[model samples]
Target: MGVDRSMWKMNPERLQEHLQLKNRARQIPDKKKESKKRACRVSRRALPLFPSLSV
Candidate 1:
């Protein structure tokens, strides 16, 4: 037996967004990650390694 659309009440826009996000979560990232990389902290001096390149 088919359920009436009105019985299962949810905002149409919210339902669509939820479904889209659910589907998106299943897909793999574009890059095939070998492993998780450790986050490295850089000091201000290191950031401008090449001053000319910064501009």
Candidate 2:
């Protein structure tokens, strides 16, 4: 369902805030994937220094 027009008419600022939040929510996943990849690379690099850690 679409957002109700009356809601925006009642509080225009709420509509702006909702749209901003929606946009930010869309950007979060890509950042999470990049961070996970970086963590994996760091762990892989460290594993060679402590060979016992590798399985």
Candidate 3:
């Protein structure tokens, strides 16, 4: 089904901008996953020091 013209006011630039924002939204989760992996790596490396520091 085709979208209604009134929805975007026939503005092609608005449609392109909306598409670009959608693409950026899709990339955000991948960046979050990468940062999470880095955090997990840091925590694993620090795990050994915890027990010694606690005693």
In candidate 1, what are the lDDT values of residues 1-55, reduced to their tens digit? Answer: 6754763576888778767886797675544342332123335445667889878
Worst 10 residues of 2 by lDDT: 3-12
State the lDDT at 39 in candidate 3: 100
Tens digits of per-residue lDDT for model 2, 1-55: 7966665564678878877887898877787788999999998887667667765
The TM-score values for the models, in the order shown, are 0.34, 0.37, 0.37
Candidate 3's TM-score reads 0.37
- State the C-alpha lDDT per candidate: 0.60, 0.79, 0.79
lDDT of 3 by residue, 1-55 (tens): 6765564674788878887886898777787789999999998998886687888
Name model 2 segments beyond 4 Å from true: 1-10, 30-55
Candidate 3 local distance difference test against the native = 0.79
Candidate 1: how many backbone clashes?
A: 0
Q: What RMSD does each model have against the real structure? A: 11.6, 7.2, 7.3
Off by over 4 Å in 3: 1-10, 30-55
Mark the regions of model 1 whose C-alpha exceeds 4 Å error after superposition.
1-7, 29-55
> Could you tell me the lDDT of residue 15 within candidate 2?
77
Total clashes for model 3: 0
